[model samples]
Target: MSRVRVHNFAVSIDGFATGEGQSLDAPFGHAGTRLHEWFFGTRTFQQQVLGKPDGSTGADDAIARTWNDGIGAEIMGRNKFGPQRGPWEDHDWNGWWGPNPPFHTPAFILTHHPRPSVEMEGGTTFHFIDATPQEALRQAREAAGDLDVRIGGGPTTVRAFLAEDLVDHLHIVVVPIVLGRGERLWDGLEGLDQRFQVESVTTPSGVTHMTYTRP
Candidate 1:
């Protein structure tokens, strides 16, 4: 069966995946790019996101490079797509990733207000739908075919899937920061460790990468 996986997901030491006060100007809220500083210098991020020729190729880069491997589709919360709430006041707001999104596959956006599917460059198509985690995974798995479906997240969505035991593999990067307030990734997920065989590795970047794989 195709696996449901999450990769390069960054969380603060306190478990907050993203800070509060999200808006057009502040995509990650007050946290800004602090959560992702470890990833920014990776060769994978440099080539994939920044289109740069040179980047660090160490332990961090080694783990970050697997983010796109065998990913046929992605499921992200509406917040990860953009900061808009309620009815999408603007249809012109495609996404934060310009025309050529990095996913290069069908990307499903979980939302209360469903909108028309937007096709972008690089074979990335955004489909917005209102459904439970199971329903959304069904659609994503179908679109994913034989390849794995990636759960691209914004804490709430990831927590929902985790609670349901739908995720097969989870890679969480624990950045050493303390965000006093934000959307937490581990809320209501007590005893989550029992579900997976866990292992951790601390890279020289001072971030700990934890992998949870279902046994």
Candidate 2:
């Protein structure tokens, strides 16, 4: 079955998904980039960006491989896509990722502004959808075909999906660091009774790879 999944998402020791004061210079917010040290040192990420296999093949590699595999479509919130608030410009602004982005599948970006579909190399088409998370997921699932729908988020996006209980699986990489302030993954989650079971946990280079599945 086609399911919504958050794979290889990094969270700090203090439970912040990103650092505060996000800007063009700091997309991940302040020192939020440090949380992704595990991914940056993986062979999968190196190969995806540099076209070279010069990274480790241990726990980090296993987590990276799962996150990077068979993703038919990706859904990202406006904040995650770019800092652009209002209507997007022409096709000039592609994305943060360069020419050949890491994601090779059709990516659905959630935003209030609407734009035509953007076709990029390696089969990455950015589709701007002006709708709620549920609606976006429906469209993404259709676009994804047989592959799983991956939620590429910036905290708020994931929170919205989680609130709706639409996520089937969530794989978070808990990094050993602390961001004084930033976007948090579990904030304002009040009396809502939600439960998840740990599927697996592996330590690769001190980074803890945790997978949780809805029960």
Winner by TM-score = 1
Which structure among the candidates has the greatest lDDT? 1
Off by over 4 Å in 2: 190-194, 200-204
lDDT of the candidates, in the order given: 0.94, 0.83
- Candidate 1, position 18, lDDT: 95
lDDT of 2 by residue, 83-143 (tens): 7778666657788887887789999988888888888898898998888888999899899
Candidate 1 lDDT, tens digit per residue, 1-215? Answer: 99999999999999999999999989899999999999999889888987788889999999999989999999999999999999988799888888888899999999999999999998999999999999999999999999999999989999999999999999999999999899999999999999899999999999999999988
Clashing residue pairs in candidate 2 (N, C-alpha, C atoms within 3 angstroms): none
lDDT accuracy of residue 12 in candidate 2: 87
